[model samples]
Target: MALVFVALRVLLGGFFALTGAAKLWPLSAPESEQMKALFVQFAEVFPLKLFGYQPDPMNYQTTVGWLELLAGLLMALGPPILQEISNLFLTLLMMGAIFTLACLKECLSTCIPAIICLGLLRLLDICQSLVQTKKVGRYCRKKSVLKKPWEQRVSSCQL
Candidate 1:
């Protein structure tokens, strides 16, 4: 069970980190001509254009890039509480990505990453609940009632 979570964390975290890092390049090194060209090309695309990519696309893309990068890092290295927060952010990001891909009339293939992230989020949630349930069951069993003196006397009288 732990192995499952570890694999999901690596897969999802690595994917988000790489994609987010790519989006962040323009923000980090604006002086680079290659980065500028990449930004321009992305801004001209369907989903980015919806964000008014031409005038100031870097700011928008950079904002999203930061979100993805931080969320991915949190999922991979932070505590369980942080993981939950990261999951929420990643889920929202993926939903928006899916919506953008759909609007562009792109092939369904492009939406695979978003779908996989969402599925991983659901799986983590289910695993967490199952673990909690097992813990609660053990706790309940450990608290079984102890026999009282009065109950013992009543049983003796009955006999």
Candidate 2:
């Protein structure tokens, strides 16, 4: 189980880290415009439509890159608590991205990968929780068993 978890973490974490890092690079005007167009496509279905905020494509990409990089780092660290938090955040981001793209009727090939990553992250979180719950149950059972003899001895003495 631990090995499985580790492998999942490495694969998911490395992918996000690489993708995020790539977005941090400066692009030419044409590239920037292309990216902005993509962002506009994504924002078309976003729930924040009421805000009337049109995000700059380059800025949005950079911000998303940073988020992915941070989430990837946290997952790689293998801290259950942090992983859960990062997983939830990433899941929501991916869902929103998918929804926006779908709404715009834009077939972005990259969204598939994002969805896959989200699934993997969520799986890892569930696995981590199961492992934690198992450990806690085992500890509690051991403690209860160990206390039974002491309680019996005290009761007999009182009698």
Candidate 3:
């Protein structure tokens, strides 16, 4: 189960990292124009307006791209606690993306990538919780066994 989580983390991390970099492509690059156009189109569905001030579409796109890139890297290489936090950020980003696609009346096929990413994130979360719970339960049971006078007191925790 832990191996599964690592594999999922790498998959999700690599995927988002590549996508985030794509969104932040160089100004003269063709991909840059496409990403900018995408944000403009999505803004029509939900103007990204918070309060009374509206942010520039390109800025919003850049901010999101930066976040995705940072969070993806953290998810891949950070400590366990940081990994969880990064996962939370990524989960929110994916949710927003799916909402955007839905607002645009996109077909199911078009939304599949975001949906799949969201699912994998969810599965990773569940697996993490289960692993933690299992460890705690196992520790308690082992502690009880080790309390006997005849048995050696040994502690082993291997992930």
Candidate 4:
């Protein structure tokens, strides 16, 4: 199970890192205008426009891209808690991606990545809880065993 979690985390992190880097391409290339135009179109067509929060397309791209990049790195190499936090942020981003695709009437296949990531995150949560539970049980058992000998010694000294 731990192996599975590690494998999934690596795969998901790599995917996000690549995707986010692609999104950031406009930041340092001649394609900035074209990419901005495409993102503008996307923002216009997606559900965000319906909420009266029309953000500048470039800002949106930069924010999401950098967030994805950071989160991906954390998920890949950080401690378990940080990995979980990154997973949550990535999950939210994926949900937004899925929602946009749905709003555009994209094929169901377009949502598969987000769905898979969500599933992996849930599984990670469950596996982490199980691992923690086992650790606690082991600690309790050890503590009880150690306490018995100490108590016996103390009583013998008192006598």
Candidate 5:
């Protein structure tokens, strides 16, 4: 189970990190030019507005890039509390992406990746909660006066 979470962390973290790096472009990456062109086209098409103001296209993209890179790294390597926070941040980002694509009437395929990422985030959260709470198959077996010998289970399992 631990190995599974480790694999998920690597896969999701690497995905967001690489995608973010692609957007920011280190100037040496082969696809930097293409990514820039793509972002320009995206801004032209999407026209995202914040506080009723549209931001500069490159700046907006850069902000998102840095966010993804930092949050993804934290999600992968941070302490448990930070991991949970990063996961929530990334989940919100993915939700925004899906909403943008949907509002633009983009093809269904464009939204699929965001949907998959959302699913993975949910899976990680659920798995982490179950592990932390020790609730799967965990039960309170304290003896009860009125309960049958075979049916004394309760909800206070903490051992």
Candidate 6:
């Protein structure tokens, strides 16, 4: 179980880090521009337009890229609580990406990797929870076994 968690964390962390870095590349301007346009469209779907705070499209993409990189680093550190939080964050990020793509009538090809990464994070979280529960159950059972004979002896003497 620990090994599985470790593998998941490493794989997800590396994947996201690489993806975020790729987005930051100047040579990827075209791809980044496309992402920015998608984000603009997504923002329009909300009330962001009314606020007169139209996020600069390129800035938005860069910010999201940096966020992904940070989240990936957090996940790689293997803090259970932090991992869970980061997983949720990444999931929401992916949801936003999916929504943006859908709004643009784009195919799933580009976003599929992010979707898969989010799914993997969710799966890892579930497995980690299950493993922790099992460990706690085992600890309790061991504690009960160690106390039972002494408890019985004490009761017998009272009788």
Which candidate gets the maximum TM-score versus the true structure?
3
Residue pairs with backbone atoms closer than 3 Å in model 2 (clashes): none
- How well does model 1 score by local distance difference test? 0.73
Q: Where does candidate 4 clash, by residue pair?
A: none
* lDDT score for residue 130 of model 4: 90
Score candidate 2 by lDDT. 0.75
TM accuracy, model 3: 0.80
- 40-132, model 1: which lDDT tens digit per residue? 544555354566645455665787788988888888888878877888898887776677667666687867867887888777767767877
Candidate with better TM-score, 3 vs 5:
3
Per-model TM values vs. the true structure: 0.69, 0.77, 0.80, 0.73, 0.73, 0.72
lDDT of 4 by residue, 1-159 (tens): 678778888887877877788788645565777767767765766566777777788888888889988888888888988988988898888778778767778788877877887777677767777989999988787544345788889988999
lDDT per residue for candidate 3 within 35-138, as digits (tens), equals 78888877766535555556578887888889888889888888889889988999998898899899898999989999999999988888888888998988
Q: What lDDT score belongs to each candidate, Candidate 1 first? A: 0.73, 0.75, 0.82, 0.79, 0.78, 0.75
Best by lDDT: 3
How many residue pairs clash in each candidate at the backbone level?
A: 0, 0, 0, 0, 0, 0
Off by over 4 Å in 6: 28-42, 45-54, 143-159
Provide the lDDT at 137 for model 2: 88
Residue-wise C-alpha lDDT for candidate 6, range 1-159, written one tens digit per residue: 579779878889778877777666645778767766666776665335566766766677678778788788788875778877877888888877776666667677977875787688788778878888998988787544355888989988999
Instruction: Rank by TM-score, highest first.
Output: 3, 2, 5, 4, 6, 1
Candidate 3 residue 44 C-alpha distance from true site, Å: 2.8
Candidate 5: which stretches are off by over 4 Å?
26-30, 40-51, 135-159
TM-score preference between candidates 1 and 3, better one? 3
Clashes of 4: 0
Error of 4 at 56 (Å): 1.3
lDDT of 2 at 20: 73
lDDT of 2 by residue, 1-159 (tens): 689888888778777777677667535777667766776666555567668876665677788889888887887774777877877877777787777767766666856876787688778878888888999988787544355888989988999
